[model samples]
Structure formats: C-alpha cells, structure tokens
Target: DQQVKQNSPSLSVQEGRISILNCDYTNSMFDYFLWYKKYPAEGPTFLISISSIKDKNEDGRFTVFLNKSAKHLSLHIVPSQPGDSAVYFCAASGYTNAGKSTFGDGTTLTVKP
Candidate 1:
C-alpha cells in the first residue's frame, strides 16, 4: 500500500514561533520524499525534498528531516509568519516513477496575529 499519513488535520500557532508537522509512510518502496505547500484553489508548490539516501534537507526558514529507519519525516518552520499559513502535504516518489508523487491528505496550519 502506498499510503502517506499526516495524522493532524490542522495546527494553530502564533506568528514568530516554530511550526512543526509530522508525517509517516507505509510504503517501503518510496525512495524520494518531498514537501509541498498549497493555498486554497491553487496547486501545490515544491518546498523541499530529501532522497532516501540522505537524512535531511533545508531551504531558508523551512527544514525537512527524514528518518528512514522509522518511516517518519517532519517539517519545521522557524519564526512562523501569517503568510506561512497554508496546507502542507507530505509526498513520496521514486526514480522508477515518472516524477509522480503519492501525497498524504495534508495538514492545515494557521498562524495567528
């Protein structure tokens, strides 16, 4: 089963604090992991990605860490801003596939003023 799981349906935090989201997977075949951020009625944009061979990847205020042994991953955003509020999806892909991804339902984050 190629299932990705984001247990939390939503999260709320104050601006300038750290925002964290967690994900898990059931598919052992996944070799590449990606994070995508989306807003209402818009397509998801690539945020960060990590290969199965690597443990972590970072981009600016966003960081993603993967633990292959646990089949787990997380995304962290520091000094979270109201603009950062959106839905985050955890995804997995493989070099074997033509860059298609399997995504979790998504976690909605809200940053308060």
Candidate 2:
C-alpha cells in the first residue's frame, strides 16, 4: 500500500546544522505521525511525534509538524550531531488500532563533521 512515502532517499548535512525530513501520506484516518532514527545493527529509535489533534509538537532539539489537510508531515532536528546520522523513518497509525502502523521507506541521513 502506498499509504506513506518518503520521497527523499538520502540527505547530507554538515554537523551542527539542521536536518529536515519530509513525509507524505494518503490516508486521512491516521491519528499519529512519528519519526524514528535507526543506526546500523540497531532497531529504529523513536525521535519525535505529532498527534492528529495537534499541528506541531517539539521536544528539545527535535520538532514534528503535521498537516492534516495535505496529509503531509515533517521532522526537523536542530544542531544535528554526527551521531544523528542514520536511517530515519516516518510511521503513521490510526486511532482505532494504534498498534497497526504503516511506515514509509526510510531516508538515510549523513551528518558530516
């Protein structure tokens, strides 16, 4: 299912800069939008998330913005460090069954020092 899509396959940025990742979804039933960062040999680690009730949410250096009308979302990481380099994934889930999540193809980000 083309429920979610991450158009960018990869991104590169200098250390201490901002890293922005984009995501799009076709389902309007989605209630949650989340971003996860996965390093090699490890599972995806949750970064930030935004609920359908909220347009934007921020935690420390990470921010997640959701646009319900357009079915689009984005994750922003400020002052990204080299360790932040990884495969970032965008996932969506409906409220009816939060456990049933649909994920987009991940975008690999390289933060060069």
Question: Which candidate leads the pack in lDDT?
Answer: 1
State in Å the error of residue 47, model 2. Answer: 1.4
Q: What is the Å distance of residue 46 in model 1 from its true position?
A: 0.9
Which digits, one per residue and each the tens of the lDDT, describe model 2 over residues 3-98? 999999999999999999999999888898889889999988888888899999999989998888999999998989998899999999987675
Backbone clashes in model 1, listed as residue pairs:
none
**Alpha carbon lDDT at 10, candidate 1:** 100
Per-candidate TM vs. native? 0.94, 0.95
lDDT, candidate 1, equals 0.92
How well is each residue in 1-113 modelled by candidate 1, as lDDT tens digits? 54899999999999999999999998888989989999999999989988899888888999999999999999999989999999999999885772688999999999998
**Which residue pairs in candidate 2 collide?**
none
lDDT (CA) per prediction:
0.92, 0.92
Off by over 4 Å in 2: none
